[model samples]
Target chain A: MWGVATGPLRRRAVAQNLSTTLGCPVLLLLAQGYDRPSYVDVALVLALLGPIGTLVFARLLAEDLDEDPPRAQALTWAAAGFAAAVVLAVCVATEPGRAMVKLLVTGALLIGGNLVASRALARGMPTAEERHG
Target chain B: MDDALIAVALLLVAATATAAVATRDPVHQALVLSLLGVALALLFTVLQAPDVALSQLAVGSALTPLLLLLSVRKVWRRRQRQGRTE
Candidate 1:
């Protein structure tokens, strides 16, 4: 979060995207550790909504970001993998059931949204010549 | 284990909240606030309040940042307009 708050526009977008990708699994682990299935809904919501939030930033700040967009392909993939591993582990622990389905859904959404946000942030910015011309 | 989980979540909440406050730029602040929102939601979940966590996730993750960034954009645009007019 601080990473997002104290950097250039590119870095801030990257940090915001990364946090969304990463926060979902932490929420999942919290749900599993607490033995509260309902709590998983929080993870679900975050997974679904976090990227939308980043997209909000990207769209709202498009002109500012068009100067030098940020990219985090590696970080985004790593975060997605982490989310997959956590969701899988929680699924294994909880066994096959409706809850397991929900966990898988959350993981998918988290990874998908992370990728989308990362791609958006990584879009090429206008070069100086392009901006001036 | 429960105490440990709760402690960790609380610690994260504290750290992220501090980072959010310490940030200077409005854009950066918006980004940090989103992270803070996630941290707070996690804390709520750990403390056995999913309802609170759910609302926190909704408001903190998207709405707050959206409002902040939108307002920032607006202010900048207004300033740009004034500069152009002048």
Candidate 2:
């Protein structure tokens, strides 16, 4: 969090994306450790919205990051995979049922959104014409 | 075990909140604030209030940052226009 708050724009954005991705596992852990299935819903909503917040930064700060974009492919993959593994382990513990299905959905959304957000952060937006006009 | 987890979450929220306030830049503060929101939501969940966590995640993680960034962009644009006019 400090990294995101103190670094330059590029590092700040990357750190923001990384924070959202990493949040998935912590949410899952909280759900499991507390023995509350409803807690997973919070994780689900977070997974869905974290990327949207990153996209907001990417769109708004396009000019600032145009000179030098940040790319951390390995880190991005690691975070996504961590979310997947944690979700899978929990699903196994949960067994096959409605709750497991929800877990699977959350896992997919978390990884997919994480990938999309990191990719957007790495690849600067196209020219204004293509994006807006 | 859950006690330890809750303690860690409380620490994370505290640290992230401190970082958010410590940062000078509005943009960086927004980023840290977003993360702090997540940590706060997790803390709420650990405390057995997923409903509140859900609302926090909705507002803190995405909406707050979106609003802050949009306003920041608008202010920057206004400043640039003013500079050009001057």
Candidate 3:
């Protein structure tokens, strides 16, 4: 919904990051049914990379994004909240151990990275002239 | 139950692939392609191949779109410069 609803490049990038990092991980974890805890590693990588992906789009498409910077504060927070809820739920399901810690770290990265990425996109990257000067 | 998940993921992949192909603009195609990457990763996960899904997520989710958009930007800049000079 978020990806399709937004027309702006930056907004779509955020949506893509959110879906890939938070949404898919949670769904994949649930589908995995905790059969192999190693699967959580996939989410870990995604949590780490998804926002960086958005940052790439923000930096490269600065001019396009500058004209219509997305102010998606509400949506970003909602996604973060959802990530928190999913993490808490998964932690509850798993035993209190290293795996749980890993999940927590992934959750933190997912939420923190997402917020940072969204803010970066909203602020827009410095133009080449501003950067060089 | 697993079948349901697989079916949903397959449907998503199909839809996004079609959207990516149907889109005319390179920029829009890149966006759809990113989404398509996510969808494919989901399908791979549902099929019980986290390793494959991991690589797909890494390559598809960010790398592919980054490369595509970067090239598009470069091409557009060159075209604009040529247009100005001509």
List clash counts for every candidate, in order.
1, 0, 0
For residues B1-86, what per-residue lDDT tens digits would candidate 1 score against the true structure? Answer: 77897898899889888887788888878888888888888788878898998999899888998889878878998999999999
Misplaced by over 4 Å in model 1 are A124-133
TM-score of chain A of each: 0.89, 0.91, 0.82
lDDT of each candidate versus the true structure: 0.84, 0.85, 0.76
Give the DockQ (2 decimals) of all models: 0.78, 0.79, 0.57
- Tens digit per residue, CA lDDT, model 3, A37-121: 8888888877887787777777777888899888878878888888888888788888989998988898888888898888888
Instruction: List model 2 lDDT by residue over A1-133, tens digit each.
Output: 7668776788888888888889877888778876778778888898899999998888888778788899788988888888888998888778688898889999998999989988888887887678865
User: Candidate 2 at A83: error in angstroms?
Assistant: 1.0
The lDDT leader among the candidates is 2
In candidate 1, how many Å is residue A92 off? Answer: 1.8
Q: What's candidate 3's DockQ score?
A: 0.57
Backbone clash pairs for candidate 1 read: A5-B28
Each candidate structure's TM-score, on Cα atoms with residue i matched to residue i, is: 0.90, 0.93, 0.89
- Which digits, one per residue and each the tens of the lDDT, describe model 2 over residues B1-86? 66887898899988888888888888888888988988888788877888888888899887898899889889999999999999
lDDT of prediction 1: 0.84
For model 2, the DockQ equals: 0.79
What's the best-to-worst order under lDDT?
2, 1, 3
RMSD of candidate 1 to the truth, in angstroms, is 3.4
